[model samples]
Target: MNKLLEVKDLNISFHTFAGEVQAIRGVNFDLYEGETLAIVGESGSGKSVTTKSIMQLLSANSEIKSGEILFNDRDIVKAPEKEMQKIRGKDISMIFQDPMTSLNPTMTIGNQIMEPLLKHRKLNKTEAKHRAIELLNLVGIPKPQLRIKQYPHQFSGGMRQRVVIAIALACAPKVLIADEPTTALDVTIQGQILDLMKDLQKRIETSIIFITHDLGVVANVADRVAVMYGGKIIEVGTVDEIFYNPQHPYTWGLISSMPSLDTTEEELYVIPGTPPDLLHPPKGDAFAPRNPYAMKIDLEEEPPMLKVSDTHYAATWLLHPNAPKVDPPLAVKERWNKFQKQVGSLNGGK
Candidate 1:
């Protein structure tokens, strides 16, 4: 796969009345062409901040303290606002979490989709309207011609999301960032949106950065997974590796917390303690406080990304050569074994 977007040691901080909140502390990742890379973590774990930086969409109070966002060899962090405008909806685009707020209540859906086409693609009115109808149809919104004229209020949550997607894909963006795109919909609708996005990716050949806290969604849509915690990426691997061989304690907790298909347990496993405060960022491993398997070194020093495989890396003291061998929780281990067995059987060998 072609390396399309590269983020290197990206540090982001927000200057608020409280203090400087170090939201992203030396983050790094890469996006490949025509692939979905899911950024998974807890709500405040810097998943959104990191991806938003790719589009240069951080707020006024936010600062890119360091690092580079390289898209097509162009440094996005250093790109001026005038240049960023061309990239925002043309080269890269975003689908926000809430479709309710993403769309304009007063504007017709057609005009909304056409706005980007006109601005970025510089299509005239007649050409833009034709493409708008095509996009509406492409996103599975029925009766593109008639539905195009309808306001955001007329569409259901799922339909509204399709419109939002249409707008995001207006210029056939090279990179598409879907930040919790399916969060606001029902289960059925969520599935539909996921299917639609996968379909669209194949059709348009766009690389995707999918940001979400839901590991289930990550499992469904991601080619690779980057698991973040306490504003840093604690683990990253191919989807199969992350699902079947996750190494980080936080990744184990996240997977174990999901409601199991085979288990009828009423209570889900929760990771103990709260996330660390970014205002005063931890001097050691950021996740040490919440990690049940945390060692003395975990509290004294930050762990580097230890190599598990060429495609897998995890930052934890447990991955150290001198550290004691400790297994994940029973639930996590069982799930991992089950996943391994499933893959082994599919490969027709042990």
Candidate 2:
């Protein structure tokens, strides 16, 4: 697949009264055409910030210290406001996490969806409304014609989200960034929303960047996974590679913490310690404080992303050739084995 977007050496900071908060620290990743790339991380891990930067949606206090966000061979970070305006909704669109906050309560559903069509597509009132109803129906809202006339409060939470997705997809953007789109919904609704997105991906052929900490959701939707920690991508690989053959200790922790059907234990595993404070960032590996297998080098120097395979790489000293071979935690190992078997069984042992 061709590269749709490439974020290289991206660094972002927020100038605050306290100090400069280093939100994104030299982050790099690629989003391929027609692929769902899931950015998994704890809150404040720079997942949303990174995607937000792609859209140039940073706040007044936020600053892009340095980086290049290449989208379709154009560097968005250097693009003028006029150029960005042309690209925002037409070329790329984002579905925010909360529909209540994203959608205006005063406006009718049809008008909200038509807003982009009018602004970006230069459609007339009648044409935009016609497109809005089509979008509503496209996202699986029954009786869209009738529903379009109503306000956001008239629809259920799931329906509200569907409306939001419709608005995001109104212009047929090449890339869609969903920032924890399912975080506010219930489990059953979450499944429906995810299924809807995957269905849309196939029909629209648009690349999706899904940002969330839910590994379960990642398994359901993602083609590739990028694990982020301390404002950096600690590991990145295909779904099978990250889940079955994780290299970074942080990746192992995340996989092990995911709820498994094979596990009978009542208590779930949780990674210890909070993420590092970015104001006074650590000198070495950011995850070293919580990593049980961390060595002296992890405290003194940062580990480069060591290639584990053609498609897999992890930033951890443990992946170094000279580093002593150490097994992942017992719980993690067991969970990986169970997941591998589960996947194999599902694939008919092929």
For model 1 the TM-score comes to 0.95
lDDT (CA) per prediction: 0.90, 0.93
> Model 2: per-residue lDDT, tens digit, 289-342?
999999999999999999999999999999888999987778776776676676
TM-score of each: 0.95, 0.95
Candidate 1 overall lDDT versus native: 0.90
- Winning model by lDDT: 2
Clashing pairs in 1: none
Across 1-350, the per-residue lDDT of candidate 1 in tens digits comes to 88999999999999999999999999999999999999999999999989888888889999999999899998878888999998999999999999989888989998999999899888999999999999998999889999989899999999999999999999999999999999989977998999999999999999999999988788779999999998899999999999888899999998888764454566567888999999999988999888878889888899999999999999998988899998877888676555445446544765
Clashes of each: 0, 0
